[model samples]
Target: MGIVKAAMAEEESKRQTAVEILMKVGFLDHCEHHEEIIFTVGGDEEVTGAYKYGNANWTAYQGSFKDRKDMTDHIKQESENSDYANDGCEICRSMFEKD
Candidate 1:
């Protein structure tokens, strides 16, 4: 991979590692938003991904986010920035248009 791709991958790895850290700290088990988190890496729209899982589905959570809100909002912001209007998600361009 090129330097940029390598860097991106490394960043993604770091992001995931932060999440693992959260796992070790019991954030996923104790945080108020533990059950619902937006999982993403790289902050790249093309290859970036977002997924949500409930607290019951996970055992641990850890990270370096500003706070629980930041942790929960990252994926929502990413999905919104990507302009994805899926009903399964929280927001969409269509919703904005409808308002």
Candidate 2:
């Protein structure tokens, strides 16, 4: 019972961390499921990005920013406050690396 409880707690923690990362990046609304979560990104009410996370995988199919610099800046600033700031999703590991 204790072991099962511990695993459940860990899963919840990971889910929360995923939410925190998405929220910091401007994802205010999301759809969650047992196997995955999805979020739509908007800039000036225009759809900019489509993001999905599943089983530890994070994927960004599109991005809307002034430029690469702008995107990087936004990500860097928001991630600074998260516990996973230094440990981004595998797909984003390169984009969110420490400065």
List where candidate 1 sits over 4 angstroms from the true fold. 29-99
| Deviation of model 2 at 99, angstroms | 50
Poorest 10 consecutive residues of model 2 by lDDT?
47-56
Summarize candidate 2's per-residue lDDT along 10-98 as a digit string, tens digits. Answer: 55554455355456446433433212333434332221221222212333311233344434344444333244322224334444575
Candidate 1: pairs in clash: 21-62, 22-61, 22-62, 23-60, 23-61, 23-62, 35-55
Model 1 lDDT tens row, 1-99: 999998787656545544543333323222233334333223333222223331222233323344444444543443343333222224333465789
lDDT of 1: 0.39
After TM-score superposition, the amount by which residue 34's alpha carbon in candidate 1 deviates from its true location, in angstroms, is: 13
